[model samples]
Target chain A: MSGTFIGMPAFSPPTLPAFSPPTLPAFPTAAKEAVRNPTLRRNLRYATHTIRAKRAAAVSELDDWAALREAGRQIKDHTLRHLDRYLLQLEESVTAAGGVVHWAADADEANRIVTGLVKATGESEVVKVKSMATQEIGLNEALAAEGIHAYETDLAELIVQLGRDRPSHILVPAIHRNRGEIRDIFTHEMSEWGRPAPEGLSDTPAELAEAARLHLREKFLRAKVGISGANFMVAETGTLAVFESEGNGRMCLTLPETLISVVGIEKLVPTWRDLEVFLQTLPRSSTAERMNPYTSMWTGTTDDDGPRTFHLVLLDNGRTDTLADRVGRQALRCIRCSACLNVCPVYERAGGHAYGSVYPGPIGAILSPQLRGTASDIDASLPYASSLCGACYEVCPVAIDIPEVLVHLRERVVEGGPAVRQGAKVTLRPARGHAAERAAMRAARWTFRHPGALRAGQRLASGTRRLVPRTLPGPGRAWSATRDLPKLPPEPFREWWRRTHRPGGQAPADRQEDQR
Target chain B: MSSRDVILGRVRRALADVPDDDTPYEVAVQRGYRRAHGERSIGETVDLLAENLADYRALVHRTDAARLPGLLARLLAGRGARSVLVPPGLPADWLAGELPTRVADDAELTPHQLDRVDSVITGCAVAIAETGTIVLDAGPDQGRRRITLVPDHHICVVRVPGQVVSSVPEALGRLDPARPLTWISGPSATSDIELDRVEGVHGPRTLEVVLTSED
Candidate 1:
């Protein structure tokens, strides 16, 4: 930790990797650790099933849900196509409403700009609303490097911060954690942060919630600076809306004097009317609520009402890169609802931490590869994480075809191509790890084209069927590790068909019964 | 180049493939979603608001003009509140001859001081029935945003038929976006813990909305 004195030298940054660290173990390896933890598996299963059923019910209530989904998709697509214009318009609107706008090209730039803004405020500590953008950029760790502490005010965020853990889900970051674990975190860690957990804190959720409110209340009341991310920003009005269940968002947004919003450039709606579609879809999809408990909206700063000074930081770490791809741009349309994650069989089995970015699950599988690129093992492995299940696509509020994008990115990975990186187009070599898979695919393609060769190969394999084992060896062992390989038949299908039926032959009785 | 120009240049380049005749916003979106779930009369809308409000655990009270003051007084008395927060332009008779000491909302009352107070009473800007939302725009009756936020108990008076709208779109039409608006469906709540919905976190622990027949 930094020295306690004001003028004293700050210590070197922690040896620990920052939140949502830059690289993670490959998906299969990371997911292995998650699948082994029965507690995490049970927690995710229970939480995901509960929200999934509720979301289906909430969405079913709206007869216009399909139309709303299409509209949400189109509206986001339109805004992105014309983002340069809308962004300038948004800057103008926000400035007109008495706010300043700053632009950051990448994560480090965003961190630099925010750290400078906080230093300028002459404040060393800032209160934070739960923001995925901030988490994505490692802002908290960056601030800590400069001797500033950012207090996470959201209940789930508070649980995460105190536990010194990474968030696993978008809407519910602590979904993998249970009540008992939370009680332990609060009991042990609350005193170091601010107020200690209440005496005899139990595992009851309400009691734990009260303890969090008390612990964070002091920070919220005294916070001179507030940092946040928004759900939607209106270009027409320069209004930013934050949707939250707990009043922690309300406290952080209002109680502070200087407010800094670090938003992705894409969270833009042209007007308040455009907000109606997202307002209806996001809450139901994310939290299964008709309306979240509180939605606090401010146009710049209000007079003595909320923060007096507002700074809007528009971040584009790799968004431009993602947007440049035609097939992959739909990933940008996500509202971060996590419906895709909940419905994903892969996510349920593997959990959120495996995707290794702030974004995880189907959306993450496609998004992380594009946002961070596929050069890394985890990013390259993300596209292959799914079973090509269409469940995630079926539930996305913005109708992002996650499976389609996953396939597109897989193609990009296996075949060398041009992709945008850090705002410039670069030609990428085919990822090193996928070479074996690529050769196997190419060999299969060759065989499919040669029917006579395929028949001969199949007949030879069929002749020696008993020699083959139930499981494969070498690189193929990964496949048969969890599954039994199909046993080859004694005769190839072509020969069986030739023998069973013809102009002068009849269908075999045993084959007919099997077919029936 | 400034990051602004760099980002904008990249965005323009990203969309180089878009045709000159992209779908206009008006034609592009089909917002055929029913404006309101089902058509209901004014009274029915207010009833739906109360039902949904109660559904989310917000206490719903109904009274006409004459009994409104008594109902509010009883609520305050029931909670055993000593210090009550009063917004600037709340109708005088709504809580006339009330028992609690009126701590008027002003600049001097800090959040901590407000937290010390037992309850806050205000009038809402608009109420949406379909979602069971009460919007406080910090208008004359709602005072500053913190007055409603800091106190543990919130009693908002909604003059039914006049203040109630059937849907969110209808409510948005009535609200001015310039104001510091808080849309509250229930007391501050969280489903963060194992996805179990628990009411009362940082905002008022108990929210009591009174739907008065007399506007």
Candidate 2:
């Protein structure tokens, strides 16, 4: 049975258009477009607020939530610190369990390895679970380039694929689309994929979910190869776990003859027991459920149960660069719960597409700049997307200090500094257009060093307080356009302090002393 | 160098700043979380399991060993299921009464064949009360993973007290890591459209969990 792929004949590849990654504008430009769409703003607002309230309630059910969050953080930290040791151990365990482990240094290498594996099986189509890692690497496009079709089986992913749209949210990829939009996508696009939507489909979520169930079932039953990405890979036991609400994850993981899982090296914990912490925190934080509907955990392979041939591709893809910075490395501790996205005020207004990556919201603001490097216009602008309200950090299950990383990335963008890219150490020049800000900062530093210049400047500013405009001219106009400038005090603090506390005058400190 | 060696070298280089006397894994993490939420007796735990399972839209049934077959018959008859998939290790007495056509889970049963079956009945390895989860380890009674998944209706029998745990941590202790385990909270559900959760997608739309105790 292992000689031939099981369940179905080798079908011809479907004729889908080749995917070319889109070049997106910077955060502010994209955000300006997003906020103007009233429909998008309302959709994001309702989804985020609803999930936010439910998540808070789910988390409050457990009194020891803080302890669980800390344990999750420390476990990830400890694993990442000694990652080489744990990865080697994991490789040994998986190999011992009759599975082949492959390592890919970058997205191109990972894609090449996966494509070759699928070609080896002689299968033109593969079923997929909803996986962030696979999306991050653009695996579907890579396979499509090789004449292999990758079918996304998750309900949200199905909507996104059918609509030919990019994923907007981590947990719910099609969060940007309302039920009416989704019904249209399914009704119009489902036939082109495999099965057509039922006649006269309605706009209710239940009917939409039912349509998705029927459309994906045909592909699942006949699938010969399955591809996925795991939530956690236990180093001690060589077990990979995928947490999902839909049954698509189970069908993709179980029915196929060959299963290939592309997982990030950082998605590992030291032992199986560590799952106790994340299992409690992830579901409640992500979907606001006590536990997701289905969580599948499998070690390499068994004789009579699931997939017969198991392959694990451990992907690096710029993770090593993200690990170099001590402060920024905390972003690796993310379990992808996406609680931060729901609570983010900026994400609510600008929406997920504005972030310009598969990961959006506050986590994306920090992670994209680090992993992709702050070289592109979007990557450099991502660091400034947040208001530093710190809501993301508060809702984080692993306690990733996203605000700290965002600020650190801002420093990386403004000042030329040392960074690692593709396993090579390279120094970077400050991003262009920041020269004015940099020069102003330098001049302020110089003036602060000399007390006479600072005092003279303060007096001059105080004397000409009436001359200050309500808004500044030139580049500062955009900064002050939406904000009202604070009024200048009648005199500087030093002058006021000197006048209020003269030797003959009754000082406030003396009055307090007298009262005492 | 091979890609494996290159990636490992990169990881080592990334950690060059780590001190030699760094805290080891044993002392690095603090695990102070509770094993279970609130304390409950075994019976109360099982009752909580029923309540929480129902909360997620799974049908919960309580019956003793003698009446289990009758309850199973009634459920199958109620659903008007023509064919029921049976695992190898399921007790014969559980289906002794007259029922639908039985399809045995075996090598001959393909995924497509399982798709046509109206329902699947099996015993679970362990059930968690706090999260309303039933874990299947592809055990003898549970059969292959595909049997419970492809069918539209699933009737999972859990032996109370012996198979029930209060929380996820406790459930993990009873499960083995080597086997492929599936933890099912309720039937398949999705909150994909506007974050409004709708149960029944791809998986068995009807998840009937029967808690049978041999008193």
Candidate 3:
């Protein structure tokens, strides 16, 4: 039965290139390169530290932050548990509100639906509002394939697109690029797109922002179609909300005649009232503001205001597969606040590029493996990308225990058990190249079963304590390179225990000596 | 099967682990968060709104119903706005005195035209004190969303202690979800560059909020 389902044309993975380029190296390899770049490290450090301090200050002002965080988590969990019912309700509500609803099972389907929608409108260009879902599906590239241009209107996204770079951070896609780099990108690349940067553009953020404003304003006024990814979709009212710091979102949302929004199915909240919790938590956790500069909420298409024609594409991609894991489903609770990214030590060092997915930092470590499955080298290595520091869990507004999920994913990688892939249940073989670790674990398990063998091994190790090298000879050298191998004692603990204590009830060593 | 059915089927199968007697929505989620953060008087709430709006670099002014027109005139002239977009339902008396070229918001007023207008004036549906947010619901007083968005300067009039709420939750209760809502906290700002915030981006670069009390 499963084979027949997989045989269907629609269920097959699309021929389009993967979201992350296949040539990208695994986490460790990429991270090694990223750490060597001093400029990248400095940029990540400066951005993360500034946001972290402000985030702390902003969160401190909310007295009921714990309650709000718990509520946000519970709401998301409840919504996911009964997502089917809410999705159907959402479809009904949206349709009744004069909007069209389309469902896409994966990225290809989503891109196709959006492309068809844009084509039907006779539009060759569309303005975008920094949507991660669209980025995840590589919608811009897909549209470009069809001879349509998708312009990224967000300042950070504009910089990334102009530089021909992949987004390295969630909130600020160009966080890896400093102001000087941004100025250079703008000065060089602005003309090809539409407007040229003013003569002698400086490196100040304000001036750069003004240049973007002047360049994008003409596009906004002329844009006939706008594509966006909603931050939250309310099932009860079919209301979609987008929270953004810049007015680019507003420009795209309001100026266009036709609006196409591709939203992940997991981005739903059960009721309109549930927004209060997220509205309070997301901004503080994300941009560390009491509220972002703008939040646009529309139930559907209105008669003479905003977009006259609205199309909502509900995208599953790998969300259903992600929801299948009892432990891993918590990743779906993410608000894409990127709070975890800002707080992650590993992310700060490795940078967002190493995660090799649209989502980076600790969240990506757990989410990428589940959504894409740990079949590839990058996916397999993603589980072990973290030190399990648990800072991502600490800053998560939804209270997703990221460390727990990372450890769980690590188990998945090593054990290779029953899992879902592209809506099919498949048994996974243990990831390749873990045979050595597996063998070592099996040997350790054997040694612990027999006390005599364990004692013999311990004695042999202690007898040769002086001869044990400072670092292991071959595979373990890398592990010990930056770490100090502990010095083994002259006597093992078992031998010391046997010599010092009586089997029967007796005070051990120092106490007995004191009594005597 | 349609992709909707396919996706929904997948969702049900994925959630097969959920027991038939799983907790319902009402009890499953605990909403213990406060309706409002701290207790404040109505006057104090309005004051916080003004303070916070200003904190984000929005220009805030206080006046009564009788003086509102004079204040609006002064504000537009001070900004040197050549033309102001007015929602059709905005109170005429508010702009009764000297004003810029009054551009009425109508279907013919395209986004490009709104861009040419120097400023826009509208009345808000609700004002959130904690976040310094003003919500527009395309009400009679508040025109189409684009009018406020396309122009660089926005002068919003808020009824003191009436439209103002202490928190987001309080504001939501008063808002209708069916209508489109645009919540403006401050003039457009961005923190994308090195996470350092700089004001005046795409939206209205200048937002002058007038708090009017009937008196």
- After superposition, the stretches of candidate 3 with alpha carbons farther than 4 Å from their true spots are A1-21, A502-516, B22-24
Interface RMSD of 2: 0.7
In angstroms, the error of model 1 at B71 is 2.2
Candidate 1: residue pairs that collide: none
The 10-residue segment of model 2 chain A with minimum total lDDT is A1-10
lDDT value, residue B198 of candidate 2? 94
Tens digit of per-residue lDDT, candidate 3, span A235-318: 999999999988999999988999999999999998988999999999999999999999999988998998999999999989
* TM-scores of the models, in the order given: 0.96, 0.95, 0.95
For residue A51, model 2's alpha carbon misses the true position, in angstroms, by 0.6
Per-residue lDDT of candidate 1, residues A98-161 (tens digit): 9999999999999999999999999988989999999999999989888888888889988888
Question: Candidate 3 deviates by what RMSD?
Answer: 6.0
The residue pairs found clashing in candidate 2 are none
Per-model DockQ against the true two-chain complex: 0.80, 0.89, 0.87
How high is the lDDT of residue B46 in model 1? 90
Q: What DockQ would you assign to candidate 1?
A: 0.80
After superposing candidate 2, which stretches have Cα over 4 Å from the reference? A1-22, A499-516, B21-26
Rate residue A71 of model 2 by lDDT: 94
